[model samples]
Target: MMNGNALHTLKALDPAGGSQVHASPTDRERLLANVLNTSRPAPGPAAGLLRRWRWPLAGVAVATSLAVAVSTYTLFGPNAQPAQAMTPPPLRYAPGSESPRAVLERLAVVALKDTSRVPAGSSLYLKHQGWALSTRIGQIQVTSAIVPSERETWKKADGSMRWKQRTLPPRFQNAHDEEVWSDAGAVGEDPQFTEDATGPVNANDPLNRPAPEEPRAMGKWLLASQEYAGTAEAFDSVAAHNLDELWNGRQRAAMLRFLATRTDVTYRGKVTDRAGRAGQAVSVDSAYGGLPTKYTLILDESNGKVLAYEEELTTTAGALNVKVPSVISYFCFLTARVD
Candidate 1:
């Protein structure tokens, strides 16, 4: 999605992981307003440690504000200090001789013949393990960090959906990043309560809508979908990024067909994803969120299901405090199926 909206939704990510800090509704509203209203620094040749990545963090705020019926916590308010910046290692891709179009076309063939289906009235289920660089440019201190988590979601055709995410110990690019996290007691020690969220979501949200199973139909869907969907790479990457939505084999095939048409993608040959599963890679480069980023998608070599989606810096971190050539985010699909 928007790289500026770093850490994806940050819906279930919190560096202030420990006990829940209970606060009155007024206090929570006040904190949310204060944090969201905080001025974010500009990127590229600009002055300041970047926190624009937290733009999506504001999106998350609206979610929790869905009538106080969602969730509430006074996490990393302006008064709180950010201890360290998260710098995760970049992905290592293996080379390939074939064209990305050839790889995608081949995968589409496989998806078309597959029989994976979700019963009409039942929900589609998907589970993934992912991590993203999270930086909260709070008033006190700038914090950049990563939190690993396993997330699972269920969505019905009617747009009813719910998701749960649990903290997983994170990995860092260097020892110092780890030290900063440890010193601040920011280990994954169960800081997320999004682990308990459920259905009755904002079904009208474009992302929660089920994508059609044909390229032409999906194109129309995208045209009417979010503004970002206007960009092929953005929409494709977002589909692979948010496993929260549903699509059967046919739909996945349609996605591949559409992707095959994008000339910007390059075939990266074969690679083992974070799940240690063999996969075929296709990548596209974007200066998303002002950081020159390489977005890679790995497909299961056997059936063409998405295995992982990753984003890392290609040249520099831009306005962010993280080092160049570091991974900004990654998600590995450990389980995905209609159940």
Candidate 2:
């Protein structure tokens, strides 16, 4: 059974009701199969993970069409490789010799040096491709599905924007342990919402429109706008993403300056994002509704752009006896906005 809060938040995020479609049997099977096949664990890995960490997962589950909730997925392929052969490659950047604070402080200086300007008649175009692991009811036992997804957003200074998101079918295994593609209402390929400049702006909506160019001003506006209304950390994550999306050097510098003033923000040294891109990592930790949460941003040093956004749980509250440090959601935001 879905918790009331999660259901409510999901509805709030999907006001267009795009994910409510019923799936045909054929579609459901295909989606489940994709999820399962893409998520098989290597030999001995699951047992090792389960034994090493045990924690309860709890809290208010927030669902946005862009909600990057975290779930576990075993990485495997069609031809299973031996555990010894599955080692990850070395990180491109070595862990910073200096503290995270010093690194970010230096990066802040680099950002202030940015003189890049936006092109005329250009609009912000952002494309994000990521995966989400979410729950679904199968024929017998409930299982999780990994849905490959995409989101595209175009915006201009006038607050005119069109947002589209599509989640491809997921792969999962049914009660019979047969891999299937799940078409449960969880899968959809369409624009959830789109608006032109004339569309009404909700003062409370963080994604309502373009943001202020100055960081202090942006911070003030964010507070009043409740753009990151979920938690202080949540606010930071949203603020970081939006500032990066603006693609303005001045605004980006201001964002770093604004963040410098916050006590909760911390520099997390060098870390790689989901896309295997290496960058400096900064994170914010806070409690939302008594649940501990954290959000991390991996930033490209050359351009100071945010390479990724990551959210994870700090504690195992209501989890099914899972381990801590689990990812809740993440996105590798790629922006080449003009104008």
Candidate 3:
């Protein structure tokens, strides 16, 4: 299976394939207005008569409207404020604690340290299902920071000086150069490469390795999923950011609307220790592509921040001897400090 980041990269490269485009807000509003107007009945006899005499009764109508508005405000507005102003969820972890959110945050910080410099290379060893998948794989990590030609120096907390620099070999300057380097004897032509003494070696024969294909563009459907995952009405918004960028176009919008309008959501709460913070876990059931889906959200009871979330979806298969599993999982983690 393709890794999530790789899948995202492929999708970005192929905008015409499966990409989804969302309807604009104006379009959505127009559709809603059309539905409402079509369903509404024409004015009745009394209403028509009132409309004809509306000009003469304008002052009386205004006074009546003001009276009703004041009455409604006095009766309902004050209580509504308290409900509307309810406190938000708490942070997932206390700065000094060892919660799962803290652990993940630390991991993210470490990962970012290496990834912060664009065009820089690093080697990673990954294991799956208790088996070593790769001893070492070379990666060219990029960041939002623009690449700079000059080296920069910084002092470590311990007072040691460190320097950072990035330099690409003459033959590996551009995409074409990178492609050539990917196919050279050092890296071979394999989609998967293993680090050798000289660098990463592509396991597949150069002649057999195919060029990477462009990814399909995400469409309305995927964007809907993102929106569904992003709001307080559905899953925790903060926890859903990780999945938001992975989806695009209409799918995101539909997901958001679905999450906002759906009323079938049920929440069940439990207490658990995550990372190391005491947190409350809430479970929600929903649907995706008409299939049953579940979301598990863990929120810090004190700080109101979501610590983590997990989403699961059902799957099925047709023809072939394929064994389709009933569940797919997505996850996110968060952390923060408490005063």
Candidate 4:
């Protein structure tokens, strides 16, 4: 939901429908200063002196008065009224015509193929089941893990990589519970294998586990393009994938079975551009089963990828607003390639 201030900012951007005009901070500051100076009264001593020098004072006073009037008009005149509400431009892509799944599948293929472009000693950002994991390649072994709160970058003789985990605090424990991997093998013992009753484990616990045989792909096969006026079939494909990924994990067969039993999928359409992309828009919503369990999917028209996904689990008995049952959100990039 957008508040008044946020709406005002959005209006000012004139996103999609209007041109982007950037004003330098220095110019803005100078303009603001001039406006302020014009609005203020002359010093008392200056005014007294000006009265003695009537002719010169009158000329100065006229100039000052004119400046003040202009400033006042600029600040409080017709232009000061709220900007007109602009209608958003129509969407660029048509629904059902584009195959979001095929696009994503291609994107995933391209991403996997391009993994070799990552320098032998460099790193890449990977998201897994709500966890932000990072992987770095080394001379002998690749290192990867769910980054700890205290550390931001890991350095070795060959190179270094920076990473920050963005999961909610309560979810970090669950991330640590899952196995962290890199391309080489498991880097360290699984954190869940160790127990800590008195205090959290020390650095010796080895945050960098061996890389998994296959790194979890992020920014792949996103729903990039869709026709807004089309049917729900394209949206349904994305929702299906999101639900499976959100719940199935490594168990594909079991996940399929779990998905088969679910029904009551719903879609709501709203015209809006995809975040961070121009000329792309979507009408998206959620499908839910019972309370606290729902899958939210967004049909992205810009790049033809599902731009966002969220799964929430809520309990009716818990705190109303504070509790988050379970969730994930996706933001895909245009440069992001699919298979």
Which candidate number has the best TM-score?
1
Task: Return model 3's CA RMSD, one decimal.
Answer: 29.9
Give me the displacement of residue 93 in model 4, in angstroms. 10
Report per-prediction Cα RMSD to one decimal. Answer: 13.4, 13.9, 29.9, 28.4
Question: Which pairs of residues clash in candidate 1, taking residues 3 or more apart in a chain or in different chains?
Answer: 85-144, 86-144, 86-145
Quote each prediction's TM-score: 0.67, 0.57, 0.25, 0.23
- Model 4 stretches with alpha carbons more than 4 Å out: 1-101, 109-116, 123-274, 278-319, 322-339
lDDT of 4 by residue, 1-339 (tens): 567589788787865657544668898899889898873321221122112222221112322332343344335543321111111122233344433334333333433332222234333332222211111111111112222111122223132223232222212133433333322143223221111111222433222221122212111111112212112222333433332122111222222222222333333333343344422223323322223334444434322234443333334312211134333122222222111
All models: lDDT?
Answer: 0.58, 0.49, 0.30, 0.28
* Model 1 ranges with Cα > 4 A deviation: 1-84, 135-146, 172-177, 190-192, 196-209, 223-232, 235-242
Q: What is the lDDT of residue 313 in candidate 2?
A: 58
Residue 283 of model 4: what lDDT?
32
Expressed as tens digits, the lDDT of each residue in 2-102 for candidate 1 is 67677655744766664677788899999999999986531110010111211222123211221121111114443322322445565567898888888
Stretch of 10 with least lDDT, candidate 1: 42-51
**Residue-wise C-alpha lDDT for candidate 2, range 66-118, written one tens digit per residue:** 12212222122222211111111222334456655566566667776788777
Predicted structure 1, TM vs. truth: 0.67
> Which of candidates 1 and 2 reaches a greater lDDT?
1
Span of ten consecutive residues with least summed lDDT in model 2: 80-89
- Tell me model 4's lDDT, rounded to 2 decimals: 0.28
